[model samples]
Target: MSSASTVAKKKQTPQNTLSLHYLGDRVLRQPTKRISKINQSVRDLAQEMVQTMYAEQGIGLAAPQVGVNKQMLVIDCDPNNTATPPLVLINPEIQTYSPELATGEEGCLSIPGVYLDVVRPEAVQVKFRDESGRPQKMKASGLLARVIQHELDHLHGVLFVDRVRNDLVLTEALNKQGFSAKAVQPIKS
Candidate 1:
């Protein structure tokens, strides 16, 4: 690599480049103790997660998606999916789920704008590590379910689009059902 490239890579914070959303360069983060104090470590991961999420124009992102194959993730539900209290799920595990199912338009930072109608539990109970590495569980419904399910799917190496439709025409019909992707171009190959 060139000297400038090396400097740029070194200068990259956890957020990464505002232009590179795939976070492909990031690697797996180590798991922390449930009771261990993870203020600095959590903060670093959170900052990087948000930076990567915003750079991709996504509402939420998981650590594994960016190559940090940990149980962590971040979510923002704004048009940019950038919310004030970004949901940080470290070592997150879905504990419960509603019997009700919902199909929502979903996409991925890793996969770009290709979208489809995917079915998921409309409500979910998730147990995960907090920013401090403490374990916590919460029941989520509505958009929260959608977000959590999307990230959790990543943990299993599943893409939201994969669960949804691959047929563009079917995808269009699903979008009419309120599954809108508003795709952005993938930054990495």
Candidate 2:
């Protein structure tokens, strides 16, 4: 399997690529199954996911967002920087989160045109398998941590909108995007 660094960082035309499931899609609501095996097939999917994410100009993407039921995600916070490589995480698990909290506006490739503020831990320690099936661990902070948490939510059948605290903002954003407010299954804290 090719390394995640081999995937191009530049955006391509999204036509005929993996279709991104939207906010109301049932696929996005379903929990993803952990990838029991990390082979060429999983690597290929991760490569394609990275491509799709770049095409959609998204910082991160999950398997479920593309109608796959696997616990996998691709993230590249700095797509324009060729020096940095994108990350492919299989069966990612957050081991710990910092007590500090940060609120930031979040958006999803699935829920286009709707960005809302959601609070999340300021830092996180995560463990997962890389494309090579080797276990890996990392501590992340700032935007990287937020992206990790956001994409991880997709694996658990959750959306950033669900974590949104303001109903009026979420409803208005969804409505303006031609999406039904009923689609949001709010996660109570």
Candidate 3:
């Protein structure tokens, strides 16, 4: 088989389906935890998360949003998004964050087209583990940092909708144009 075919087979599987998709009602509302022994099952779940995130045109997705409620999450911000490494984070944690902040349009698969202007740190340093149970650390900025922060929030029972920084009514208008449910609250003197 060709190298492409071989690689495809490695990433192709049924567990690659979304565990909880589209504003998953009450199930997604529950909190997630950090547990021991994620194993292959967790790996499968992460795979499914990548597929689901791409399918939904999302930059990131979380385990709790899918009903797993773990510290696991995924990031595919390779710009081109080849999905290599696939960014399968287990028992993930953010070790450091930058002081600078920025506001950009944000949305989620669960909340659909609803989006809003949300402010986040301009950069961050995150620490997490790989599917193989190996520890890893990442420092990111720009769009990549934004995506990481978004997924990390999912693990902490936070949503982009809750992080909006602009007027809610204006956000509703933006959502009609395919935005998230909330906007970042602006800083005032």
Candidate 4:
């Protein structure tokens, strides 16, 4: 797998790149399949995903957001910092979550222009395969942890809006963004 640093961290709006699937798109709701084999194709996808994320000015992106049904995601919380490398996770599994929760504003590439406060574990321990297919375990917190959890949700056909607690705010936000509230499949706690 090529190093993520090889891709330019600076945001660019490239034409003909992967198009993001919107909230109401069926592709965003479809569950992704675990990658059985990681190869050049997978690495290529990861690279492109990173590019697409940068193009969209997003901090994280899941394969489902680009109409791909694969358990893969790319994240770069600090896109402007060339020193920081982007992350590519394949078949990520969260092993544990911190009992303490934090509430923060969350947004999705699939659900454009709708940001809402959502509560999630402040920290998480996760296992996944890197771009090179090597097993990796990581403990993430703060924005990185939030981004990981949000992207992981996409792999399971779940969006952050589903985790939102206040129906009125969610409805208002969705409506303001021109997305129908009916499209959201709320997750009952």
lDDT of 1 by residue, 143-164 (tens): 8789988887666555555454
TM-score of 2: 0.94
Order of the predicted models by TM-score, top scorer first: 2, 4, 3, 1
Top of the candidates by lDDT: 2
Cα RMSD of predicted structure 3: 5.6
- Give each prediction's root-mean-square deviation over alpha carbons: 10.9, 2.5, 5.6, 2.5
Rate residue 22 of model 3 by lDDT: 49
Error of 4 at 65 (Å): 0.3
Q: Write the per-residue lDDT of candidate 2 for residues 36-138, one digit (tens) a residue.
A: 9888888889888988898889999999999999999899988888767898888999999999999999999999999999999999999998888888888
lDDT of each: 0.59, 0.89, 0.66, 0.88
Report the Cα lDDT for residue 40, model 3.
Answer: 70
Candidate 3 achieves a global lDDT of 0.66
Error of 3 at 79 (Å): 6.6
TM-score of each: 0.66, 0.94, 0.77, 0.93
Q: Where is model 3 more than 4 Å wrong at Cα?
A: 1-16, 79-84, 170-189
How much lDDT does candidate 4 score?
0.88
Model 4 CA lDDT for position 133:
79
Sequence-dependent TM-score of model 1 = 0.66
| C-alpha lDDT of residue 134 in model 3 | 72
